[model samples]
Structures are given as structure tokens and as C-alpha cells.
Target: MSVFTEAEIEYLRSQLLARLATVGVDGRPGVKPVGFLVDFATDEFVIGGYVGSGMAASKKFRDVEANPDVALVVDDVANIDPWTPRGIEIRGRAEAHTTGGAEIGERLGSAFAFDAAWIRVSPRRIVSWGIEGSSFEFSARDVASLPTSKGV
Candidate 1:
């Protein structure tokens, strides 16, 4: 079973961008908007860009190597008339990978393909709001507490 609910997964798949927060070696926090993909096979959020010489040198990649803690937020306004907003916040450990972009590329298709380094996040906690198709209150949970949470 997956850590995320079906509705959450659907929301995740519908969004292409997320705000990734990481900590620098000097103990500073940094957040940036990045293109992200959910790899259900491994149950991780993959963050990276197109295959390029500078990908490995990016700040986010460096931050992950120095510190594994990370948070990712994907959200948007769903409606104007109702003033509806929805989003998911995931806090987890992240690992920097120097390879494994080819598989991600296949899933992204040729136009947005990548063969460069990437970062994978294994969520330990999750918070969501406004996507349950009912109420707008936020719900938070510790993913590790769940029986099938991949023990994050």
C-alpha cells in the first residue's frame, strides 16, 4: 500500500512544480521552486532538472548531501468563485543521487527528459488540506506511524 491516499496521489500527479526546502551546511534554510515527479514504484518524490553539466552543482543537490532533511510543498488555487485552495506538505529525508535520471526521463517523455543527477525524498510526515472533496480543514500525520509507511 502507498503512504498517500488516492486523492492525494491524484493531486500530486496533477501538479508539476513544488517548493523544495533544504538546509545548507552553514545551518541556513533555503527554499526554491522546482519541477518534481512522484515515482510510485519507489514511493519517493524525485526532484531534478534536465540532463545538464550544471545539475550536479546545483545548491539543492549540495544541500541534500550535507543534510538529508527536506520538505516539499505542492499547492495551487483550485477555484476562484469558491476561493478554494489545496495543497500537500511533505517533510522527509532526502538523498542525492548522481544517476537514475534515465528511468525518470522515460516517464517524462522525450521533450522534458533528463539523464542527470537527482534528489529523492522519503516522507516521514505529511500534511494536506482542501483536497478531500469535502471539508477544507488541514490534516497532518506522521508517515512512519502508519503500518505501511515504508518505515521512514
Candidate 2:
């Protein structure tokens, strides 16, 4: 079962950037733009960034470690005249994974260089808007109940 409809999945594939939000150990909120991929097989979002250094050594990574709760949003402006906005927002638990040779890294392929860490977000709830006429929300159970396509 797929959490996203085929059209929604296609929209995600077309987008390159997503905003990731995390809560710090001290209870401050942090958000940053990230290069990401949707891992359909695992139904998770994957983000990779440099490990051993400045930015990664800072709050966002620490926040994920201390608190796995996170939210990611991927969106784009379709038209300026009509003031149209569309995107998907995902709420999930995230885990920091070893990089430099992980499956997420391979899937990302050239998005980042060597020595990066992966943040895999396992989605618990998903909400999408403007893809169709109205917005739709899906829980993990709703996603699980979707019928699979034949000939997989």
C-alpha cells in the first residue's frame, strides 16, 4: 500500500527541496532547507548532510538524536497570478543513520559528497493540499489499507 496517490508521488518526484523541522534539546525549534528523496519502498523521507563538521555538528543533528519527532514540508508555487500554493507535509519520527555508503546515500546519488549522515523519517501522518481540488490527510493506518497495484 502506498501512502501517496500516484499523482502525489509524481509531484514529490518533481520537487527537489524540502524543509525539515526539529526541536532542540533545550526546546527551541529549528528548520532548514534540505535536499531530500522519497524512499517509496520504505515510505520514508531521506535527507543527507555533511557529518564531521560545522553545521552537522550543531543543533539540528543533536535535536534529532535527542528527540526523533520531526516534520518535513515540500512545496512549490504553481502560479503567481492565481496565488496557487501546493505541497505535502509529513509528520514523523526520524533516525540518524550512518552514511558514506548507505542505501539512502546511494539513492541520493551525487546529491551530496562523501562523509555525510542520513536522516530517515518514518512518516506517521501525511497531509497533502492543492494536488487535487481539496486537501487530504492520511494516517499510517490509512496508508496501510490502500490496495496495492497488480504486477508488482
Candidate 3:
């Protein structure tokens, strides 16, 4: 079974950009808008891009190597009249992988071909609101009990 609820999975699939928060070795927090892929087969979030100098040279990837803990947020304002905001926040351990970007790129289509590298996040905790039925609904859960596939 997937750790994400059906609604959560659907929300993730519908979104293309997410903010990845990582703590550098110096204790500074860094956040960047990145292209992401929901890999249901591995039940993890795959973050990478074909922009800039590539994922391997990025500071976020280096930060993950130094401090694996990270947070990823995918949110948006659903409406303006009543002010509805919905999103999912994930706290987890991230691992930097040197390869396997081609496969992820294929899954995400031609626009995103991370071919160089990517980061895999194994979610330990999840908090989400305004995703299910109404903006009033909120849920949080610890998914540490689930198995992790880091190197795989």
C-alpha cells in the first residue's frame, strides 16, 4: 500500500512544482522551487531538473549529502474569494543518487530530463490540509513504520 492517501496522491500528480527545504552543513536553511515526480512504484518523491548547472552541482543536493533531513511543500491558493489554500508538507530523509535520472525523466516526460542525478525522499511524516473535500479538513500522520528504499 502507498503511504499517501488517494487524495494526496492525486494532488501530487496534479502539481508540477514544489519547494524543497534542506539544511546546509552550516545550519542554514535553503529552499528552492524544483521539478518533482511522484514515483508510486517506489513510493517516494523524486526531485531534479534539467535547469541550471544540473542536480549534482546544486547546493540542495550537497545539503542532502551533509544533512539528510529535508522538507518538501506543494501548495497553492485554490480560491481568492474565501481564501482557500491547500498543500502537503512532507518531512523525511533524503538520499542523493548519482544516476537513474533517465528513467525518472521518462516518467515525467520530455520537459524534465534529470539525466544527471536526483534526490529521493523517504517520507517519515506528512501533514496536509485543504486537499480532501474542504479547506477546513486537515490531517497529519507518521509514516516511519513504512519500509524505505534508499539506495534502491
Candidate 4:
């Protein structure tokens, strides 16, 4: 097993969006399931105005405001694609975007709802495993091999 190949990285971005967001509040940690839309164009994950944004998302925001450290797990539960039986867990810091935040300087986040912020993955570490048979693993760094949008 190795780090995510160039191809696998993009596939993961294009295929899966169901994410588990971990947020800690009042010294108690919680995991919330949420639907995220991955934007390959800018290599960013966006969450918008939706009702079932898991539990304590707003609270999580407050938590992030207090503590920037966070964790994320994005997976393909159906095993439908080549990377099927594979999931990636990212451990990194997180920051909540205010109306006039630096990166939030754009309108993308605030577009859909009052809380559309980008989950900037700092990529402290990446671990991917093969869920199919048993003996598979991968570790990937930056998306160096990712192709840019030329015609598309």
C-alpha cells in the first residue's frame, strides 16, 4: 500500500461527500454525519444551508472558534468505485469562517446559507486503507499529480 495515487485522489474527491465531522463542546466530543459537496475545481469542501447537518454543527462551529484542532473522515460506504472498500481519514486543524474571514473573503461559503464556510484541509496526515480483502493501505501527500482544468 502507498499514499493516494494521483488518480485515486481525484476519484475520491469526485465520488464521495458523506463526511463525519468531529466537534468537541464542553469537554465532550461528538461525531456528526453530514453531506458535503467536494469542489474539485478549487480543491475545497463546502457545506451549505441544510437542515440535517448532523448534531451540534453550529455548536461545533463555536468549538472550532475556541479550538482550531479537529479531525475529519470521508468515506465511500457503497464500495462502488475503484477505490471502493477504501476510506480516507484526515487529521488537521480547523477554523470557523466569519462573514469577512481571510479565505472566506469569497462568496462561496456565505452563498448557500448564513454558514457556508470552507473546510480547509491542512493535511497533517492522510491514511487510506483497503476495505475489500484485508491487505491494502495507502498514504498520500499533496495533490501534486492532480490535473488542472484546462478544457473542462
List TM-scores for all candidates, in order: 0.87, 0.80, 0.90, 0.58
Which wins on lDDT, candidate 1 or candidate 4? Answer: 1
lDDT of 4 by residue, 5-118 (tens): 465466565553545455566677766565455444445444443423432356766766767666667765444554446666766556455433223423443333323343
Question: Model 3: what TM-score?
Answer: 0.90
lDDT of each: 0.81, 0.71, 0.84, 0.49
lDDT of 3 by residue, 1-152 (tens): 88889999999888988999999989999999987887787778888767444778789999999999999999999998898999999999898988877766677563755656888888989999999867778899999555666443
Clashing pairs in model 2, backbone N/Cα/C closer than 3 A: none
Pick by TM-score: which candidate is best? Answer: 3
List pairs with backbone clashes in candidate 3.
Answer: none
When superposed on Cα atoms, how far off is each prediction in RMSD?
A: 3.6, 5.4, 2.0, 7.4
Give the poorly placed runs of model 3, Cα more than 4 Å off.
107-110, 150-152
| Minimal lDDT window, size 10, model 4 | 143-152
- Distance from true location, Cα of 23 in model 1, Å: 0.7
Global CA lDDT of candidate 4, please? 0.49
- What residue pairs are clashing in model 1? none
Q: Which candidate comes out best when scored by lDDT?
A: 3
Q: In candidate 1, what residue range of length 10 has the lowest lDDT sum? A: 143-152
Query: Candidate 1 versus the native: TM-score?
Result: 0.87
Q: Which sections of candidate 4 miss by over 4 Å?
A: 1-4, 37-44, 50-57, 78-84, 100-119, 131-135, 138-152
Tell me the number of clashing residue pairs for each predicted model: 0, 0, 0, 6
Q: Model 1 scores what on Cα lDDT?
A: 0.81
